[model samples]
Target: MKKIICLVIAYGLVFTPLSILFSCTVEAKIVSASSVLSRQQAIDFVKKAQKNQWTLTEKDYFSLSKVKSTMNPYFTSAYINEFVNVGGKNTKSGWISNLRDTDDVTGYLPYDTPGKEMTVSYSKDKKKIYVTGYANSEGDIYKVTTTLVKTKVGWRIEAIKWL
Candidate 1:
């Protein structure tokens, strides 16, 4: 009986601190995962959302309806309509035209390329997130700021401001 009691105490001593340390490690991982996840989500959302800017041009039957429909999933309804322009007119106006002045090919955004770099910042309440990035090569530099709002479904972009 004494041997059984001693074995139980030995097992408790050997495993108790390891269990405590394991729990602490798990908690630390949880905190780290959440922080990293939010930042990555903001970046990924901007990359995916920005790629749809091509829908604003004429080749794809540039309809305000189509533009809104394509972007609505990523942006708020009130702001989705702001990006639409028929055939990318006005040269210096609208999002796509303002970036490259043409819709036939790639613009300055540099999707998934090495010349782009981005950073994330959050509002005090963490309800709003800003993903700021730049695409640069040679002598030209184009910067953009993408703002996102957390919603019931998930995060939706509020606006894409070029700077």
Candidate 2:
């Protein structure tokens, strides 16, 4: 009788948690795999950023914020700390100082000023995007690529590379 009782108790204890674990329902929220933005929409987002507004619909904001956060700190910092001189004599030192001052606001300094032309391309899987453009200050073209993933908050950038 003792042996049987112990066996039953052990079986009960082991199966009880297993039953609960198997019975519990976990539902994964599903988003459309085909919900990525059209090519035009992506380009428009860049244009808006160039204007310094960085405006986006609520849905796009999540994705945009991810890209903004991952951008080379220097590139993003230029916009956040932008300053204009009205009449101050623009010496080489003044320009360098201004660039350094921008670091105070964004904790990074831009490699160059805003670019004139911008172009973007996205992978068919919608997991990667590449942007190439010219900067007004540096007079050199740049290519920035970002990787994205979908989350509960929507699409977000996972990484950024500047070339």
Candidate 3:
């Protein structure tokens, strides 16, 4: 009886973690978007950000607080902490700080500043979106990959990579 109980407990410990891990993986795979992020929307979002009104405008940004609220639990704890707790110019340093200072979430681009127009693309899985900005005074075409995650409220920008 003791050996049988020990075996049952061991199996339970092993299977429980496997079950939880598998469930998380299945949910993570549901990131594909039904309504893809369009070029026009990206243009508008960029425009608003360049004008330094993305946070100000009622129609564009959902507000920093709203954005914070909509963030996914999957995001890194350090990223979330910095994102939520960033402060003035002296101490603030991180993606969140950059996100705050730059008008565009993908970092300030020439397209947004010069209004040069840009292109947008999506991953095959539709889990990631990219916006490529035109040449600036520096003649640089900024390729930015902005990740938006689906949440209970809808979808929210979670991370950005400016290449």
Relative to the true structure, how large is the alpha-carbon lDDT of every model?
0.57, 0.38, 0.43
Query: Over 4 Å off in model 1, which ranges?
Result: 1-37, 55-60, 85-116, 136-139
Q: Give the higher-TM-score candidate: 1 or 2.
A: 1
Error of 2 at 47 (Å): 3.8
Summarize candidate 3's per-residue lDDT along 52-111 as a digit string, tens digits. 423322232244544344333233333444444432122322123334454433322233
Which candidate tops TM-score? 1
lDDT: worst 10-residue window of model 1: 1-10
- For candidate 1, lDDT tens digit of each residue in 14-127? 436433222111222223322423778778877777677544543423445555677777877767545444323432322344334432223223444345568899998887
Candidate 1 global TM-score? 0.57
Instruction: State the lDDT at 8 in candidate 3.
Output: 24
lDDT of candidate 2 over 1-163, digit per residue (tens): 1122111212246436433222333445443633565566555444444333222111222333343453322133333223222111134433222232222212221233363555667777665555555433245444554334434444433433445
Q: Root-mean-square deviation of each candidate, in angstroms?
A: 12.0, 14.8, 13.9
Q: Sorted on lDDT, highest at the top, how do the candidates line up?
A: 1, 3, 2
Q: Which residue runs of candidate 3 sit more than 4 Å off their true CA positions? A: 1-34, 49-115, 134-143
lDDT of 1: 0.57
